[model samples]
Structures are given as C-alpha cells and as structure tokens.
Target: MASLGQMAAQSDMVQGLNAGLRRVPPWVLYLAGAGWAGWLFYLAATGGLGVEPIEALEHRYGELALQLIVVGLAVTPLRRHLGVNLMPFRRAIGVLTFFFVLAHFLVWAILDVQTLSAVWADILERPYVTIGMGGFLLLLPLAVTSNNWSVRKLGGAAWRRVHKLVYPAAVLGAVHYVWLAKGFQIEPLVYLGLILVLLALRSRPKATRLAR
Candidate 1:
C-alpha cells in the first residue's frame, strides 16, 4: 500500500499526464492508426515484410488488434487504481481495434486464401478461424453502437450491458491466437495470460465506471 503522500504525488503526476492527453484530439489516434496500417500494407507490398509478406501482414494486423483490445480493457483499471485517466481515447482505440481486425480478415481472405469459397470453408472447418470469426461478429454490434446517438437511444445501462460483449470477444480472440499458432509458441500464450489477468482485474468491484 502507498502512503498518503506517495498517493498524492502519484495523483498529481497522473493529473498532469491527463492534462497533456487532453490537448490531443482523439481523431489523432484514428489518423495515426490509419497511417500505421497503410505503412504496414506498403511494407507487405514492397517486400519489406519479408518473404511471406501476406502472412506477415495478416499476423501483424491481428496482433495489433489484440494489443488494442488489451489497451481498451486497461483504461478502466488504470483510472480506478492509478488515476491515469484515458476515457477520452477509449472509443478511438476500440474503433481502431475493429479496423485492424477487419484488415487482418481481409489480408487472410484476399491475399492468403484468394477465394471466397475457401474463406468460407476455412471459417467453418478451422476451429481457430471459427473462433476468430465469432470474436469479430461479437465486436460488430459493439462497433455499430459505439456512438453518442446509440448511447442516447439504448440508455446508459443498456449500452453498458451490450458493450460487455467485449469480454467474451476478447477471450475468443486470445483463444483464436493460441489455436492458430503452428506449435507450442510462448508469445500467444503470453497474450492469453495478459488478457485473462485483465479480465480478472475487471471482475473486482468497480471503483469507477468503465469507459467505452
């Protein structure tokens, strides 16, 4: 446990940090996300992503989506425990996460599979792909409703309840990554463990309202 003085100092530091964050618009994240995605795509196209550029690009996008999911989940806990508020950027993070997820799917479907029928077959036959698709489907509704108008229409309680879909979707995503790995790799397991820990943290009594 932190002493009162230490906690106060931490709080002061967090306030300063959040003040800096406030000066930056959330749309900046969207622009950065778009630029990063374009850069990755360019790398894949120009042989910068190595021999198996398509696979690399697909994996990169999926990994980014997963990382962003982790970030989105962390915002609440960070604010509650450390007073490091990130509420303003959470929505942008979520939307960008979905964009990366969609990019991952497109790269796999268009560049790797190269056929609509094959993509369908993979979704049905491959357990990992099936899990990933399920995660994507869950996020779809959340993404659609991630707006002020939807919040107004659904009511706060209903909107929060619907957004809870992220929990299961995150689990499915981690599981998908674990299953998709060629062998007993440690990296996917680390992501799964991190996600599980974050989810466990969320199960605790809420010190603050969750940010969308």
Candidate 2:
C-alpha cells in the first residue's frame, strides 16, 4: 500500500483537488464557509431555495458531510496501513464535516419547513427527520470540542470516546437518506456500503486497540 502522501500523489483526482485546495489559506476556508451560508441565504431570498432546492442542497451537504466523516475515519488506517501523513488535516476535515452537517440541518429547518412548529412536528412524526436529528446531535459534542483545549481538558481517551459517535452518526445519516428517498436507490446504497466498509476497517482488532 502507498503512503498517504504517496496515495495522494498518485491519484490525479486527489492531486488536482488538493492542488487547488492547498492554495487556499486557512482564512479562506472560513470565508468559503461563510460564503456558502450567504449563498444559501441569497438563494432563499430570491425564491431559488424551496423544496427542490432544499432537497438538492441537503443532498449535497449530506454527501459532503459523509465524505468528511469517512475521511476522518480513514486517517488512522491510512497512517497505519499506508504510512500516510494525515494528522494535520484531520481536525480541519472534522470541523468542515460539522459545518456542512450544521448547514444541512439549517436548510431543512429554516428553508424547507420555515417554522419551528413544523420542524418540531416533523421531528416528532417523521422518521427521516428524527434520524437526521439524531445524527446531528451526535456531531454536536465533537464539533464543540474540536479544539486543543477541549482535547486537553477531556483527556485523549475521553475525547476519543466522544468522537466514536461518528460511527453511529454515519449509520443514522445513511438511514435518514434512505428514508427521505422513500425507496431503495443506487446512490444511497452505495454510500451506505462505503460507510459500512470504512467503519469495519476501523473496527478491526488492530485498529480498535491502537491508542490515540
């Protein structure tokens, strides 16, 4: 197996993507996030963000969030199996995952439902919404403690325990997507399979026993 850096270098997809992404300063990622939120707002104000828009937005956001979660899960495996250097970007990717999940929930609550009462009812009555909310809830603590101080305060073991919620989060997220679609579909199934495999890889004895 190739090292993480070697893996990154070998793939045109990764290389091209990282080449453009590397040019972005840390502040630019922040700005990009703000820009995404602003654009969503603009689309809503212009009546471009309605049911179909919300569906599209949430679909994309959910996909991105899943990818980030998977990437975070892959870090240890990549480093161990491939001898990759993935530590530096792990936190950033995790943070971005949280950000996208937040946006996904916001778009659903604000743009799709447009009322707290409606959102509340959906959470109560809708299985998809409930599962989605559960996934979001799982992400909350991880997002809040992404910083070094929190890690130090919580200790690595405790923090790792909290972060393990990502596994359930991913499972819930896939179920949410499948329920939302109302039927079996290729895309959601593919993601579901990928997430399961990634999770299984992380759950192996060697991976499981490795200390953070």
Candidate 3:
C-alpha cells in the first residue's frame, strides 16, 4: 500500500501536513502518543468499546506497537532511499512503541486475565505470549539505552551493536502476531513479510554507480 506520503507527494496534503507538523513543538509528539492511549481509554471508560472490547484493546495496542516498531525500522530507509528526514522523532517513536507494548501486556495481565498467577501461567503455556514477552524484553534494553547518557557510557559503536537486538525483536513481534491470529489470517503474515523485506533492505551493502 502506498503511504500517505506517496499520496501527499502528488497533492496538496504534503504542504498541509508539513505545515501542521512544523507548528507543533518537537516534544508534543510524546503528548500525541499519550493522547492516543488516553482516547482509547476514554472510549473504554465510556462503554464505546465493542462487544469484545478486551480483544479490541489488545489488538489495538499490539498493532500500534508493531506499527511504531516498523516506523523506527523505516527511518533509515526513508533517509537513505528517499532523503526524508525522520531522525528527530526516532527516539520518541521507539520509547512510545515500548510504552504501547507495556500497555498491551498490562491489559492482558490485569484487565483481561485479572491475576498475576494467570499471567504467569499464560506466559508459560501460550506461545504467542512467550514470543511477545521475549520481544518486549529485547526492547527493554534498547529503550533504556536510547538516551545520550547511555550512548556516551557505552560508546556509540557498542551502543549500536547492542541496539541491533531490535531486528530480532521485530521479527519475534511479527511471529507473535501471526501465532496469535485465529485460523490462517493474511494480515499478520503480511506484516511478517514486510518486516523481512525491510530487514533485507537494511542488510544490503551500498554501492556507487560508476561514471559512464
């Protein structure tokens, strides 16, 4: 699917979006992420959630987390391939992704399951939960190291090496999504395939074209 970017490039939307984005302070992106979660909560509080609200909440959280993860993964590609700069928001993107993942886990463990024991039991018995938890754990260190302090402490190269854990973490996230879906759903598989392609793109070596 073509992103809004592609559509906007061919229309007036790009200018409007860029103008709106410029008017917002850099820090406000954090608030936007928080506001999104708040809106979801508001919906739930007001009984706006559908028949299977718990599932809906879980799906939304996990999906947003994955989408944000993919966003982080796309930053490099956008810069390298399209010359679009998203570097400024990458850290916030990562942090918010982890927040959503944590929220999803909490929703499952508290609101849905309603017990620590059951949470533990589900973690042990459910493959999807196990994989999802593993991915979340992998993201923990990256989130912790995202700040300038950790970058200085670990050295830039070493920090980058450690952060490479995100590749596996993203892969595991997709696998968890696929396993959790009922029957043979194409959506999760599509996400997995897209992740694979993005990772492959990242792995390729850059080359310069020779003069004719």
Candidate 4:
C-alpha cells in the first residue's frame, strides 16, 4: 500500500494532468468568476438586469451552483475509483457553490422584487421560490462552518453530518429548477437525473466505505 505522502503526490500528479488538459490556471477560474460578477453589475447599471435579466441570471446562477455541487460530490468518487485525490478542490468548489447560490438569491431579492416584503411574500407563497430558499438556507450552515476552526470545533463526525445537508439541498435545488420552469423541460430533467445518479453512486457501500 502507498504511504499517505505517496498517495498525495500521485493525486497531485493527477490534478496537474487534469489542469493541463484544460490549460487554465486556478487563478484564471477566479478571474472568470470575477468577470461574471462584473458583467452582472454592468448589466444592472445599464438597466438590463431586470425581470428578463433576473430570469436569465437566476437560471445561470442556480445551474452553476448545481454544477459545483456535482463537482464536489465527484471528488470522492474520483479518488476512490481512480486513486486520484481531489479532496483539496472539494472545499473550493463547495464554497463557490455557496457563493453562486447566494448570487441566485440576491438577484431574486434585489433585482426581481426590489422590496423585502414582496420578496418575503413570494418566498412564502411561491412554491418554486420557497424550495429555492430552503436550499439556500441549507447551504448557509455548510458555508459558515467550512473553515478549519469550525471543522475542529465540530469534530469530524459532527462536521460530516452537517455537511450531509448538501444531499437534501441538491434535491431541493433540482425541484426549484423544475418548478421555476413552470413546465417540463429536458435540460433540467437531465440535471435532476444526473444528480440522482451521482447521489446514488456516492451512497453505495463501496463509495461510502472508501470515503471513510
């Protein structure tokens, strides 16, 4: 069996290969995220980020969050199945997922409604918004407790349990997407199916046991 350092080194090699294939540095990813935020601000300033803009922006944000969730979940499986350690990227992806979800909520609240009371009412009365809000709430604790101190405070078992909320959050997120579409759509359904498969793969005894 490989030592821990050997395993980590091998994993780093895998990550390097993967990153090289994409030909984009980690800093470039951060730059892209910043560019996205800048573009949104520019649109808002130009009176373009309103109802239709809100719809497009919210959909993109929600989809990005979902993709990040999928990527985070994939890390474990990639490690187990390929001996390619990706644990380091998990935290970054998870945090970005939370950030995207925040953007989704903020766009809805600030751009779509522009009134706290109206946003509150929609969150309470609209099923789609309610579901989305619930997912965001679930993400909140995970985001807050993602740091080293919080993990140390919670301990491994407790911290793992708290992070497990991601499962339900993913489900709620998919439902929110479906509900927001207001009709059956192939793309969202595909994402829902992919999420379900990822969850199922992650839940298998081999996967769960290996994760430990």
How many steric overlaps are in each model, in order? 0, 1, 0, 0
Better of 2 and 3 by lDDT: 3
Query: What range of 10 consecutive residues in model 2 has the weakest lDDT sum?
Result: 21-30
Better of 1 and 3 by lDDT: 1
Please identify model 4 stretches exceeding 4 Å from their true place.
1-32, 43-51, 206-212
1-212 in candidate 3: lDDT tens per residue?
98998876744654565456556675787899999988997777677778778877877888999998888899888767755557778888889989899888888888899989889998999988999999999999998998999999999999999998989999999999999888999999988998898898886744233322
Backbone clashes in model 1, listed as residue pairs: none
Tens digits of per-residue lDDT for model 4, 59-164? 6777888888878877787777775555655767788889889988888798779999999999999988899899999999999998999999999999999999
The lDDT per prediction is 0.93, 0.79, 0.85, 0.81
TM value for model 1: 0.93
For model 1, the superposed segments whose C-alpha errors exceed 4 Å read 1-5, 206-212
Model 4, global lDDT:
0.81
Can you give the lDDT of residue 52 in candidate 4?
A: 65
Candidate 2 on 15-122: residue-level lDDT in tens? 565566556565555567667766866775577767567776766677777777777778777766655546667777778888989988887788778999999999
User: Using lDDT as the measure, which candidate wins?
Assistant: 1
RMSD of 2: 4.8
Instruction: List model 1 lDDT by residue over 64-115, tens digit each.
Output: 9999999999998898787888999999999998999999999999999999
Better of 2 and 3 by TM-score: 3
Cα RMSDs, all models: 3.2, 4.8, 4.8, 5.8
Which regions of candidate 2 deviate over 4 angstroms? 1-52, 205-212
